[model samples]
Target chain A: MMDRMAVTTTTRVAELHELLARHETSPAAGNVPVHPELVELFPRGLRTGAVYSLHGSMSAALALLAGPSAAGSWCAVVGVPDLGIEAAADWGVWLDRIALIPRVPAGEWTSVVAALVEVSALVVAAPPEHISPGEVSRLLARLRTSGSTLVVLGNWPRAVATLTGQVTRWDGLYDGHGHLRGGSLRLEVTERQRTRYADLELPVRP
Target chain B: MISAAPIRVLLLWCPGWPVLAARLVQGIAADRALALTDRGVVVACSPAAQAEGVAVGLRVRQAQHRCPDLVVLPHDVAAETRAFEPVLRAIEEKIPDVHVVRPGLAAVKARGAGRFYGSEEAAAHALLTHLQRFTADELRLPVDLRMAVADGLFTAEHAAYSSSARQPLVVVPTGRSRDFLAGLPVSVACDRRLANLLQRMGIRTLGDLAKLPRAQVNSRFGAPGLRAHQLASGEDSPILRPRVVPPELGLHVAFDPPAAQIEQIVLRCEPAAEGFVQLLTRSALICTEIRVTVQLEPDALFERLWRHPWQFGKTEVLDRIRWQLEDLATEAVTTDDETLGASVLSVQVLPESVDNAEHHAQGLWGDRPDEKVEHALTTLQHRLGHESVLTSTVAGGRLLHERRVLRPWGDALPTLRERRLEQPWPGTVPGPSPATVFSSASQVQVLSADGAPITVDERGTVNERPTWLRTHEGQRRIEQWAGPWPIRQRWWRKVKQLNRFQLVDNHLTAWLLLSDGAVWFTEARYD
Candidate 1:
């Protein structure tokens, strides 16, 4: 029953997006750009005032934030205390403009995220373990009012889209003797609202 | 030619100030015999104590003998100075340009204030009335406050002291300062040693000192005598200059019911914070350092000085208030019953240091994005407690984790990192740096092709090449690998050593592996 409700809500959200798309302006004002390789997954890139859920890979979730961050938008990582700072920097996210709030007390999680959305262009957070659907909807409302995007690292009940990636192949190795370099990831993007799906192979840099 | 006479100055002298300040802090009655003792000797004594035969130079035991009921308190100069700050601030409230001659006394130019208040006499009365009300109401003590106006600070101070208890204020006419000083003893012009010498030289009164030839006085008593003789002749020294008072830029809010909730307190202070920022903005100034003082129930106070790399705005001010309140709340909840674990009575924000905002304006293109980012970060910090939001900067350290330091937003970035980054660090991990460093290293098993565990030798060399890696996540094939970089740290003491290796699995994910001769662990990942 919950799944069905989520699906209907997703469809309603998609219809809302389609209506918005018809009135959308040029790329400069509509959505933030992403890496070219992942363009097939998000053809028009990540939209402002939207939330995306990324599963199975922390690196990919951080990658989604790097593009907007590099474009001079301030980004914050909330509730991920163990996130690797070096990895975020390696992904081309500007470290100076990035704030890390590794922990938010259970009661203050909503307030903290709302505050971050007001000032930050992008907020990547790991939803707290026991957040209710109502809280998610309220946070989404806040994000919309502030015109900031939220990238959730785990399952979000009504996320606009969910992007999941699995490692597909390893490169830069010679008979298990050479230094470990980089690899490729098979990314599967599911747009919840439109019930659309896309797949692509994206390069992963170390 | 008469050198321009010292501008008329008013001195507010609190007699036996050290004792008064001590009594003010202790809440002791003025009628009680109290003496502030320094090094076991009385430095200052109250009037009631003085009448009981307690004098400044008397030993504590002797003073106790003279007045059995005398309260002997140790002289705390710092406490006296701290207690006197509010008194100076109070005087400054009415008279703008008051300068502290010392903790006990303050001087201000009376000429301008006199004209503004209609007359010098009226001005003195107004000042005395204000101080009297302040002492009786704010300090809740009956102190003998005296004020006097004259040509020079020294004479003015003396006049205040010499004035009878019935009429505490003495305002000498402009040209009568010379006449007022004529009959005063020479001890008023110089220290004890010089006063003794002047008495021996027959200069008993200031008039007698003024009678000596200037060059003779300079030669006999040196510079001190010349300065004294000039002062005795009613010539003003160059010391009394009116101080330039900085604008008072502090806003305060009182909670009617006294609030314990941090959010409620912050909300109440929001309007005042906005007004404060707007006030500074209108003056083209910005505050770099602010003092947030929280008054708790029953007189407990919590105050902290916060500094910012850039000028603070309303958001930053609110963040500081919330941070301070949160800290106070936590302290109250965790501490003993003796701590003041009560609601906040009031909050005061005082801008300690300010700079011209024009100097900090963004360049021609206007850095709007940076401003927005700062505002957002500051707002976030206010919402999630100050410690939750942080920016990482490099610092001096031998280890990777130690080298990276996190500072709260709006704080000055650590400068130690830049200098530390230049130093040669042997045994440091070679980069391309790891994409993600684990907060703590996780144990992993590196197995040979036959599934036997690979171990490092005493010389930091691996016994066999690992073909498989087993972690909490599960096992995977090792596709590429490098290094057994050896690092023996603190060899002289516990003699701990480690061998590090870079490993890549079939999925191309890289891990930094470490072995302490017995076991292997994954310390970081290159995602």
Candidate 2:
């Protein structure tokens, strides 16, 4: 029997490219101009305007949204607004093109979140003071429909818990002297959800 | 034969965190987990525990009945996450990129970090030692966490969970990731739905899951299943995201405050201007115009612009701004004016141009010459305020209203007429009526004193019915008259609506005008 999981991913990647091809207006050949950060997370660029909540280090997000191409790409970080904005600016992201939506009380934020999803490529939203299974599913659907990626910044969404693909674990270790060993650390990213692919660990040396 | 790279994972699951802590208290590296509660320590005695013959949800009495020697302790979520940060920080100080997949689990790239710390196995040990230190500090507890470096993230996660003190890190060879996951359970592969789906398909092991048709699995499981498929086959490498540089011209200077007098302010700007000029010199660029901000205590912050001067010189630039500050003091009768006492916190310089050859040629010679033209404008704007020093340029338009553009000393963009006019602009209702407008515009109602309807015919004529109009500022009666000017615009626009109105006046010197649901107040007399 053919490996079901491996075949699904290959076909999915092809289907996505076909959809993106339908939206291309410019005559640029080969690959479309995509934000590099999205490329790292999802090798293919995410859809233009949607909500994605990436729950990880500030540096991780910074690595993606730091260039002229990012300006036209709008993102709103919900919980850590100041840190997110400052880091975005540090990464060459323009302030004029970006909008910062403040953090709201628990459980009340989702009502207004759908509004922002229309114009932004990525939105960082936490479950309002409380998170519901419906809200998580709805958020995922909204992101998928809008061609956006959602990064739930804290715990993984309990509703749609099945994980697929590689999950990278990050860690920072201090040297004997304690000075930051710049760009010198360890990284462990493993394949958690897949069909044809074997579960593997990706290690970064420098 | 080339060997493949391995994924480095830090697994921290030891059942209940407290049970693990209790084990450490007994001078053993605890593998059992526990939690602290309001009443006392509570061990997470559940099915997974009871499967091993431990009791489910009971007091210490009942739990001990099931397994008297069972490891027990308190629960603490905060301690786990907190104690976890230092271990991460310690690893992060050495790694280029690190991610905490869960409170206890971490994913690190092994190739780079392993080389820095030596071999892959050695790097794993160093991390374990560091984490042991962190865990030891938190509960004075001994911990036996494990590390697994494989080709993919899933295998590493599984390996970490399965590893014991006897065999910590299972370093799988490159291209062997697929083989390693063959025997792993599919339950560990996903959350609930896919896990159930895989179980339904009778595919419990990763190898069994990989055997099914991919297209069918993807269509059935949706996005999450598609991802699961990719991982089982050992695809999707985690690429590290790097930072990009920002482009902006910023200059900042902090000063000791409470400095009074224009002379003192002028003196303060000298160094700032000099510093800005020095920066421009180093970059081989000349700033055409500069914006100066004056910090006024107890009230407001004042901002102005300086025009681009022809000559470029450091001395000239600083001297001109100094002169502008000094002139402001003398221009006012009393030096105690609101504008006089403000001290400048810092000055910013925008490099408006780098096209000048003289600047580049001078830079080639290692000489940082200052710009005299920018210096002159800086002073002029400082003394007269930015708005006072304006430049005018002709703009293309059929109407006199749109004929010209005005700019302050340092502001860069051209003046625009329409609100967000870049796209299909909204044109105002048309009429060739007034030569000038001033004061305010108000709305009015036309009527006869006896309440009989006063009619105004088309073509700007009023019948002898004693018609009246009202001013918006107040509901005063009409006192004067002007011809009715009817106009239409956007005839080409679809679904067009009428926006026509007549000009009338209310009682008193105040004049009122009405059009298209809006009223305006204009002055009666022309200069």
- Report fnat for all candidates as fractions from 0 to 1: 0.40, 0.00
What are the per-residue Cα lDDT tens digits for candidate 1 across B2-27? 36477788889887788889887898
| DockQ for each model | 0.16, 0.01
Over B1-527, each residue of candidate 2 has an lDDT whose tens digit, in order, gives 11133344333333344444334334443333222332432345433346555543466655555665555555555565655665566556555456666556667777776788778788878877776676678546555677787665666776676777777666766677678788887876678777887888788887887777779878988877766766777654454232111135434444566555555655666676677665554443456665555554555555556554332455555644554555544554664653454555544444445343333332321221122323433444454454543333334432222332344544443535432334442333222112122213233455566644444444334444334544344444443344333333322223123233323233112221333322222322110
Best by TM-score: 1
Candidate 1's TM-score reads: 0.52
Model 2: number of clashes?
118
* Model 1 agreement with the true structure over A126-181: per-residue lDDT tens digits: 88888888887888888887867888888888787887766665545454344444
Off by over 4 Å in 2: A1-206, B1-89, B95-107, B112-121, B131-148, B153-176, B179-206, B212-228, B241-467, B472-527
